[model samples]
Target: MTGPETDNESPETDDEPPEHRRYARYLELLESVQEADEAGLVAAVLRDDCVAMAESAVNRHLERRAAQLLTDAHFPDWARTTAAVIGDRAFLSRRLREWTLLRAIALDEPWTAEEVTGASDWFQRTAAAAQAVSSPEALDLLAEHGRTRRVRNAATLRLRPPRRRPG
Candidate 1:
């Protein structure tokens, strides 16, 4: 049965660009998901719509807002710890660094202590690599390192069992 259309239920018109559509969707999600628990908010961020919005965001304000939302969202201790490690890396662009760290936290499941340590070690190595390079190359190297570290961590987390709480 058809229900009355609400403001958010309206579909995008044919003329709207995909980026604009995604941005609108992200805004809607952001409003509705604000009160969601950490896991729920992380799940929202990981949705295909949100990921597309994040990747295609051309407006600096919007991008920064989205990163702030992810950072403010409740995350597990391990994810927060890993994010702190990533945040401390030198020679990385603050925007890219924070976004990448938030993305890692969003993707994180129940993580082991060893896995968290591995992420910290990876960021440390990446920071060292950045330090070894020229200024311009350092930023590029750090960005590359961030991407590589996130990919490796995602793979590792996928293979490891989810952490169990003490009964």
Candidate 2:
């Protein structure tokens, strides 16, 4: 007995495809992240899935903000890279192939600000962890991590070596 569907009808109904439903959920989560205070932001990012979704979401502003939040929280380089790779899909795809190189040098788990500071080679450790991932989404995550690591390392190499201390 329902009349024609109106433009204002909620998109959350069973009529929507699974992808649309997931996207709607992502949008909701993005709003929650945007509304969160610093502590809440930290908590949200602690969930690996949340951070992973934040990286690949279509909203550039959300992606960049998520990256900034991770950086502010002192997350490892891979985490930072995850958020940094939002704009270029082809670039992200290519980076996935080189993920194995990161195996020895990255951190494989989500960390708090306190935990991240003590880790060495977070990129390599994260990459190593990523080796087990088989899905395209997981590959995207690994690719972002590798890309960030390479950029950070390159930047470091570009810096002049420290001058020798005066005798």
lDDT of 1 by residue, 1-167 (tens): 11112123345456666545556564455455433343343343334443445434322333444445443544335244334433443422343443444344344423233322335444434333421222332233334443466544444443345799999
The lDDT per prediction is 0.40, 0.37
Model 2, residue 158: what's the lDDT?
Answer: 30
TM-score of each: 0.28, 0.24
How many clashing residue pairs are found in candidate 2? 11
In model 1, the runs with Cα more than 4 Å from the true position are 1-12, 38-42, 49-52, 56-167
- Candidate 2 local distance difference test against the native: 0.37
Could you give candidate 2's per-residue lDDT for residues 9-124 as a string of tens digits? 36556686444444455455555653324333333333334434433443433334433443243444434454344324443333331232222123233323222222334433
Worst 10 residues of 2 by lDDT: 1-10
